[model samples]
Target: MTPPDLSRRALIAAGVAAAAFGPVRSAAGTEPGPIPQDRPVRIAMILYPGMTALDVVGPQALLAGLAPGSLYCVSEAEGPVASDTGLSLVATHAFAACPPDLDVLFVPGGDGTPAQMRDAALLAFLRDRAARATWVTSVCTGSLILGAAGLLRGYRATSHWCVRDAVLPLLGATPVAERVVFDRNRVTGAGISAGLDLALALAARLRGPDYARTAQLVAEYAPEPPFQAGTPAQADPAIVRAADAILAPLVAGATAAARS
Candidate 1:
């Protein structure tokens, strides 16, 4: 699907009409004129059962500006794919239909990650596509799936904090605790919300800093969370214990999947 042009120029041009329609203001710009589009980038986001909604959505919302029609949501089959939260996103292309060469190949992490790790067809698809893809990336537990495909071997990567240290070694990946870990062309984001940071970093690599900054400005990506519970270090001991308890099953399942 072609996303609407939400660029700085577009927003400024629509200011009058947008003001009439709602309380929204035109996006503020950090650069003069429009952000230059170097080239059309080809991106493929994998869709599978039980993936996290924000894992893909956050990145895609920002990166879609780099590639409009070329941004493909692909799956084993073409249709609606359900996430862990029961949200459904359409997979516009099937495995066979996705292009061999891609500027970006993105995978999301979620509850179904264990099953995806064990899917031979899915693993094969990733390994095949990653060979030619310029950037291979994952958010949260999606790094486990990439590792299962034998894609992260000898690569420094990161994932959801719960499995970053424990399970990554099983798949031959050295896990780091950073929000976004970049080992050459393989970019892995820590946990879910990190996708936003990863996408902007990638935008700078793909286009330029000015372009990414403009995209960030247009989206107003400045974040101010109300709580300090985002990471284990920041969270209270009680909260960390509860969160660990919740993720225990997933860790076990992913560990088992990686070993097998």
Candidate 2:
């Protein structure tokens, strides 16, 4: 079956419906006013070798529409960063070139994060930018890196369920097993695909619910998984065991790295 052609232009055109709507009240008990169209919202997404592409790109795909030419894919150096799946994505900017202050700062996670947790340069960059960014966010194991950078300490956050509990406590963070968790300016999403939820929730906070709803509509963001097995709690016990076995090595490595 041919999938729907939910293109960028289609999403932007559909987003116009939001202009007619009033302000949106967010879960934080605040009403977010319309974002100024005159100024672009600066966003920097960190990239590293072995990072999960979807963890970054899923959110980027939606947030990029919020402000075109404002989303920057950055790394420690300018080059192609390879994902865990062996796909390579180009970093448009280096850490030195990234703006010191940003409207949003994002980090993604994968096999690379255990190493990144110990990377002084990468941790420093996150620390510096997150200090001034209006929003700090992560997807999947990305929150683990944030925790290692001392950003998530004392804050309630979430991550890929496999390591969510093991790592957050290492940085004095309160771990929550949820799809998304928001505490003040810090937002985190669980697993790889939860980036979509994180981005839409952030869009509602940054722009308005109307705009977010439009973006959701454009993306056809509804999900109906064929199997009720996305979560360990919901999956068959045997399947869950298999998954745990597969992830045990990575989880162990992450836990050891976090403690170290």
Candidate 3:
């Protein structure tokens, strides 16, 4: 029997339908079937004032593609959450409205991390969600927030270089100075730009390396920075000193917050 020829519009509609009800194929040649609608992977990202915009946005760009309609920006109250640089990202869900069980619980680091560390409600939310989350993750200083929530006790984590060694110990977490550190389902990324790498790793874990590689290819994530000064080790002494000066206040506040 011959199949009927379809118009371009019909073909486009079919493609959209396939995307909506597509099977998540694994690299091992698993049979195609629709993902269980009732058990979609739920991702919750915490947003707070003074957070680094890139910390969350970088990871979200990749993670959003992994599961459409699953990623959520959550906060104490749903509204525009302001970042350190005055950029605001809207929180679609409030802490109370977010799902009880999450596949991924993510937080972003920023100058406001110290304040968030001291926020009892936010800490409680993190603690609760992390208790059942498959992955408790953070980018940069977000690890500090997780530690404050008592979620990172005895866990090896990473954070922004400025506070990695200074504050994590105070919160009972072993800090590693790396781009991304994963210790038993707790994944932490160091600094703002590392969020992309961290999300890619999580994507690979959740889906497969093939999916992550395809995402990377789609994003053209090849990096050729104009300068080799992304890290303190690679930067000039004067530049490193300047950067430290800018971060001194945040480091001091986070350290104090960790202790208290």
CA lDDT, candidate 1, residue 61: 84
Better of 1 and 3 by TM-score: 1
Maximum-TM-score candidate: 2
Number of the candidate with higher TM-score, 1 or 2: 2
**Tens-digit lDDT track of model 1 for 1-260:** 44445565552232121111111111332111222243466789999999999999999888877775678999999999999999999999999999877778999999999999999999999999887677889999999999999999999999999999999999999999999988877899999999999999888887667667878888899999999999999999999999999999889999999988
Q: lDDT (CA) for every model shown?
A: 0.85, 0.83, 0.82
Off by over 4 Å in 2: 1-7, 10-37
lDDT of 3 at 5: 22
Q: How big is the positional error of residue 189 in model 3, measured in Å on the Cα after superposition?
A: 0.3
In model 3, the clashing pairs are none
RMSD to native, candidate 1 = 9.3
TM-score of 3: 0.86
Q: 111, model 1: CA deviation in Å? A: 0.5
**lDDT score, candidate 2, position 156:** 93
lDDT of 3: 0.82
